[model samples]
Target: MDMKFKRNFCIVAHIDHGKSTLSDRLIQKSNIIDERKMKNQILDNMDIERERGITIKSQAVTIPYHAKDGNDYELNFVDTPGHVDFSYEVSRAIASCEGALLLIDASQGVESQTVSNMYMALEQDLTIVPVINKIDLPSADIPAVREQITNELGLDDSQTQLVSAKTGEGVDGLLEAVVNYFPAPQGDVDAPAQALIFDCHYDPYRGVVVHVRVKNGRIKTGGIIRMMSSGIDYKVEQIGIFKIDYEPTGCLEAGDVGYIIAGIKTVSDVRVGDTITNADNPAAEPLAGFKEVKPVVYSSIYPMDSNDYEELKSSLEKLKLNDASLVYEKDNSIALGNGFRCGFLGLLHLEIIQERLERDYDQAIIFTAPSVRYRVHLTDGSETFVDNPAEYPQGRIQSAEEPYIKASIITPATYLGSLMELCKMKRGEQTNMTYLDEKRVELTYEMPLAEVLFDFYDKLKSFSRGYASFDYEVIGYRPTQLVKVDILLNSKPVDALSFLSFKDNATDRARKVCERLKDEISRQQFKVAIQGAIGGQIIARETVSAVRKDVLAKCYGGDITRKRKLLEKQKEGKKRMKMFGDVELPQSAFLAVLKDNEAD
Candidate 1:
């Protein structure tokens, strides 16, 4: 196979913009998968992905297409997740490709994620073939969408392709454009083996399978390869490309996109975005743009049952291999028992991981409310990071800084005022606002990450009537009046229910949390007092009345004096219960703050 005949490209789009569907059509047209067996989102093999109609993982496949120009081309298509939470996955996938298929919905036009991904592709210096999909829909306004793409992405009219991925309309022309416009992979074949690992996952039998794009030389079976990042060596057990599933190929050469099986036992050794080179003739320098990903949100995940702790640890380790972005540490809460503090890129990332742990690993988990990492500066001129509110320092004298983000929202002009007000309430400072045209606008704001972490997105959707799309990037930390508000039940602090909040909003936040907990927690035999306090001073309080049952029900037919005596004994028992009884908080009580706080 000649390098000139190979083309590597990735598909970038907003969620449900038809990237996966378009890829399926390409595979069908290329005959990579049997036409009769072709299905929508064929690249999304996971049952969860298929059911949700979203691509959760970055997947890749190779197709051999005989173009009308009388030449056979090997096309490598890297399919990426479209959600903002998985933007890192998209970026890593793009780093392995030479071109990108920028897909947009004909009806929705350009979205926030579409703009974000397009800029990312431009940053990678990849040739982009702009595309508009779903033209078959009745709501399709091709001209309007084309104008949006041109106005927002700055792409010329001639560079765009219109197609319907569902019905295969204009797909042939798009494929022709892909082969004609995209450049062939370029590298020296004689150079030492230097492959960039874009993705990897733990295979129970194979140990670890790494997805790589051969940059300079060739990799073959039975050869020694070393990871440049970790300085670990492994014997190449097999090399292959995705043809519906893994099909072992003896060797993968320069410009080739495929997988390497090295029987790797340790997950930490095979890091994604690492360079792999021949151990005998190692490359002097690794590929550029390799950096560790920092988590944006943190949460505590405990098993529903304490007996599943060991199994839960094993499940997390296994899940971590597939998702390197997941970071965890040993965490224990007095109210919730032992658990692991987990970090994620966003709420969706957290949800996907939790879902996978429960469904795939069959481990029921109790998830605490999500939080952002806070940087605390003390009076002693020292600094520390805080992720769990339970671990917040008792005396924070100097200042407290929290992570801030640069957020972008693309929407229609009708909701601009409401959106602006909403952002202001979230302590947002206006950064930039550009009008795409007379009808649509793109607004940018600098807001605290914690404000956006919770109900922001849901509220944005509600306010904009589902027309607004949002994307955000961390913009470092900013100092604020932050305080850790603790929830106490009967004067005993519940670690799982604690949270860091602004001092101005702390009282109101504590009040809501106590109210929510009151509804979630069951009543006890003794009066249960729910108090929210900052340090020793109480800020808010709610009390649940003791369960009062008729102790004299059994003595209904007895004399009045006998009933009075029974009541006296029952009253004494209640007092004893109040003195020694412990309130058993349900798992739901720990997460009550995250719910029923739309206005927060």
Candidate 2:
């Protein structure tokens, strides 16, 4: 293979600016992933990501691309998560690449976080390739967007590539940019075997499939490669690069992005950013890099069917194969019995993970509202975890400090007022504001991570009429007045669904959550009681009345299937309820919206 063809680059963009969709188009054009199997955003590789149209999980694909000069070279495509919760992961992702293809939606050019991410890439000294995507949109102003990228991102004219992911327009120019500009891998080929584990996953049969970029020398299959940081060694079983799926091949040489299979059954064996060296003669030092991922949100995840506890454990173990930052612990409660406490990078990260757990594992899970990590100080000078505010007793909290982020919002001037108002309501203080161009304002605010992760985002967008986009990075922890709001169904408290909010916002938030729960339960075939309270004060309550039509619609004698289905539906309804003799109230229920605007 020629030394010049390989360009390791990541695709970065603001949330909903078409990063994942653009990635799908790139995969289709490169023919790396089989078109039939290549679902939109194939690199997301997670069902939650697919449903949300966001890249919660990052993945890589190596494909061949052609230049305008009629030459071909392999381009390793690393798709990155767009949210700030996964920013640390994003940094590690870009470190493995030489450059990035920055996708900017033409109508919404150079968002706040877009600049921040591109700046991170700049700090890493990676080449910048600006791509103005969604140019096919009627509102697209390609020339203005290009100018914004040039001025704000500090990239050259040659660096900007325009493409419409939906229409497959100008994608060839993107490929050309990859080959012409992004430099090949730079490393010492003669040095003793050394590789950086960028990402990895555990396969029950094949062991751990670690995604590594060879920094020096060569690594062959069947050889013993020891992770220098942990001093753990594994026997290599397979070495390859993913071309749609994993394609096993020869030894991985320096500068090549590839995968290695080690006889390790767990994801914990191959940590990200670990240095890999041959067991015979290893490197003196480990790959001393990457900041640790600290989760800002904690949630309880338990099987809706309590019998699926073992299956839930297996499912989470499998999920952790590639997602190591996700922290889970078995939690037993007097109310919910047994469940797992899961930590996530942020609120979106928690939602995405929970969504994938249900979809991929085919198990229903009761996921609690996300809570921020809290710092508790005891009189005895011994500290303990109190992620859930409900765990803290009244007057017991000497001082409570919650995590906050410096959030940046980029939207049209029309949305400026609404966004600022939204920020203020969330206890955010404006830091700076800049105009990237006419009508486009970049407003920065210092707000609690907890504040933004709540319905603050939804309200912001709704107020701005869905034109506002937000990104937040953790600034530091700050002391504040917070309270735990618990939701009780009937007289019993639902331990898993409680939330913490500022004293001011607790009542309204509890009211809204309980009402939403009521509306959701009203559609179920059985009765449910929904209530929200703070301390002993009941703020809101609603009931999902029992289905009057639940009686047999038509009894067909001797029709075993219909009888069985009727019994199944009744049994299911029975299971969904907390039987109060005759009145039943479900812990939760799901309702699908119909065009008729009527309940099912």
Candidate 3:
């Protein structure tokens, strides 16, 4: 394969902007998949991705296309998820390519994710090809969308490709432009092996399979290789490229994308963003562009059944092979039992992982409310990062700093008032606002990461009538009035029900949490008091009344004296039981509190 004839690029857009549909069209144009076997979202291999109509994981494939230029070109397509949570995957995909195809909805114009991804592609120095999708829709305002792309994103209108990914219209021109516009991969084939491992997954029978883009050298089936990051050596078991399925190739050359099976037993052995070089003739230095993924949001994940603890642990380890953004530590809770405190890039990343555990690994799990990492300063003049609210130090906290983010939202002009007001409620400071045109607006704000973690995205959707798009990047930490609120049932505090909250909203949050618990917790023999407190100062409380039975129900036409005797006996029994017996709350009660909407 000639390096000059290879075109490697990724398709990036906001969620539901026709990314997967466009990928299917590309595959069909290349004749990679039979038309009969083809289906919607073929690139999304997971059931959840199809059901949700969103790409969860990034997929890479090699296709052979005969362009209008009368030359055969090998196109390596990396399809990425559109949600903000998977932006890390988008970054990795951009690093592997020399160009990108930026897609935008014809009716919706430029959204927040589209802007975010376009800038990322620019940061990677990739040549971008702007494309307008869903042009066939009745609501598609092609003229307005083209103006948006040109004005807001600063792209030439003539350079944008218009297409309907669902109907396969105007895709031919898009293909020709890809091969003619994007530069081919440039690398020294004679140089020693230096490949960048962008993704990997664990195979139960064959070990860890790594997906890599050969940056500067060649790798063969029998050669010995070492991971530059870990310094672990292994004899390459197999080499292959994806063409609908893995087709073994004898060797992989520079500028080529493929996979390698290296008898790796666990994910810890191989790390994403790590470079691979020949063990015998290693390069002088590893390839550039390696950034470690740091999780921003964290929550406690535990097995619904204690016996599934090991299963959950093993499942997480296996899933971590491909998902390097997940971070976890052993955590124990008096209420939820043994669990792991897991960190994720964002909320969607957190949700996808938990779903995979239950659906793919068959392990029922429980999750606490998600929280952001907090920087804690002690009176002893030291700083620490706290991920769990239950572990926050009391009385020793000199000052608390919460993480902040630069958030961007794109919505219609009519929503400007409601959007800004909502941001203000989240403690957001206005940064800037740009009008894309007469109808669309882009608003930027500086807000706390904790404020956007929960209910913010939901509110954005509601305020804009499901037309707003949001993206956020963590800035630094700022001093804030923060407190750890705990929920108590029957005078005992549940660790899993504890959470960090803003002091101003503490009262409302506490009241809602107690109310949710009151509705979820069963009636006890004695009146159960549900209290929400911060350092022993009760802010909110609720009471669950005892379950009183009809002691005289069995009395049929019996004398009043007999009914009174029975009632007296029942009352005595209840008093004795209430004094000696313990109130045993069910697992659902704890789960209900953890899942409480206002807990955060």
Candidate 4:
């Protein structure tokens, strides 16, 4: 294929705004797959993605289109995830493209993530084509969406394409617009081979299959490729582009997007955002790779069985190969044994990773309560950041700070008051507010990241009746009154149950955990005391009553003294048992405490 006819673009939009559906339409229009086998979100291959109706990973496909101008073209576009947590995936997709299809729902108009993704595409200097999707809906407001494209996004309205991805209306015109509007990828095919490693996945048979976008020259089978970051070389076993599935092309030239399979066994050898070049004749310099992603939420992942520690470690390494944003390190706990401290973009990202591990890797795992990284200044004139409560500074006389995020929420005006009240309950401080129109409002707030980690998103959806769209970015840490709350079962501290909380909410949080533990812990021979404590001071406590024997029932209508004596003996036995008995903490108890604000 000629470089002039190769077009690289990505489909970007807010969550549920028809990015994946639009991709499906384009794929169908190109006849890439048989019509009998076609399905919704065809690019989303993961089970979790289809079940949840969300694209967790960015999927790329090559569409062979014959333009009306009688020129054959190869169009490569990435269908990106729209959630704020998966913004990193979108950025990676944008970096590999020369343009983007900024899809906006006609009914919903413009939302928060829609604007965020536009700015990201603009930052990369990619050409954007404004696409209005879902025009077939009864509530579709094409004029209002066009107005937003002009006024809100600052994009020219004349170039906008109105199409319903569901009904496949006006799709051919959009396909023509893609070839005519977007610029062709430019690179010198004669230059040394240099490809950017945007993504990769581990294969049991082929080892690591590296997904790359060739910036210059070409990559061929049997060529030795070197990772610019790690400087490790491997023999390229195969090279091909994705046509729904991998189709080996034997060689990938400049401006091409495809996968290169190298017989590399170790997962750490290949790094996302690293440049791949011919080892025999490498490029003079590596391409300016992607910016490092910093995770805001941190939690520990432990296996159900201690013997699965090694398997868990292997699974994480393999999972990291696919999800570059996942950050993790070896972690240990007294109660849970060996595990890994993992960092994720948000609660949703954390959940997806847990599910992928269980479903894809067949690993049963337990995740501790999520926590945001906190900055702690110790009394010894030292500064430390703590994401794990177990590593919190023991004596912290100096001030402490917790991570804060600037949240942007777009909702209907009808739910503004309740949404504002919800933010206030989360200890959010209003930063800005704007009315997008008479019906829609955008609210901005600065709030602690920890407060938003648990139920804030769920509450935002419920309060707005699923009309609100929320997006946030972590700002710098702010001064906060922080305290470490520990859970003790029968006087023994469970390190896995410890967490850091705002001082004002520490007592309430501790009481909630104690109560949850009480319900989860079953009755024992002796009373089991579950206590939430700060240092030596106990903030909250709940007692699980002891299971008693029917000594009195056996006595029947015996003498009163006999019954009294038996009762006294039972009391003495209980006292002795309480001194030596160890309360068995079930996995359910830990899980119960991890759940946030569930009904008792």
CA lDDT of each prediction against the hidden true structure: 0.89, 0.76, 0.88, 0.92
Candidate closer to the true structure by lDDT (higher is better), 1 or 4 = 4
Model 3 per-residue lDDT at 385: 90
**Quality of model 4 by C-alpha lDDT:** 0.92
TM-score of each: 0.95, 0.83, 0.95, 0.98
Return whichever of 3 and 4 wins on TM-score. Answer: 4
Q: Global lDDT for candidate 1?
A: 0.89
Question: What clash pairs does model 2 have?
Answer: 528-585
Highest lDDT: which candidate?
Answer: 4
**Pairs clashing in candidate 1?**
none
Ordered by TM-score, highest first, the candidates read 4, 3, 1, 2
Those runs of model 4 whose alpha carbons end farther than 4 Å from true positions after fitting are 554-562, 596-600
What local lDDT score does residue 113 receive in model 2, on the 0 to 100 scale?
68
Best model number under TM-score? 4
Error of 3 at 476 (Å): 1.3
Q: What is the lDDT of residue 487 in candidate 3?
A: 84
Q: Which lDDT tens digits does candidate 4 get at residues 519-588?
A: 8888999888889999999999999998999889887686899999999999999999999888878887
Candidate 2 RMSD to the real structure? 8.7
Q: Compared with the true structure, what per-residue lDDT tens digits does model 3 show for residues 1-600?
A: 899999999999998899999999999888877789998889898998988999988999999988777888899989999999988889998989998999999988889899899999999999998999999999999988887788778877777999999899999999988998899999999999899989888888888989999999899999999999778899998998998788899799899998999787867888888899989999888888557788998998989889889989999999888688889989998877898999999877887897898898998888988888999999999989988987898899999999999999988999999999999999999999988777878899999998887789888999999998998888899998889998887667888888898899888888988988888877877678899999889999999888888887888986899999998998898778767767676778766766555224
Residue-pair clashes per candidate: 0, 1, 0, 0
Alpha-carbon runs more than 4 Å astray in model 3 = 549-579, 598-600
Q: Candidate 2: list runs displaced more than 4 Å.
A: 2-5, 20-47, 66-72, 377-385, 486-494, 510-585, 589-600
Q: Candidate 2: lDDT over CA atoms?
A: 0.76
lDDT of 3: 0.88
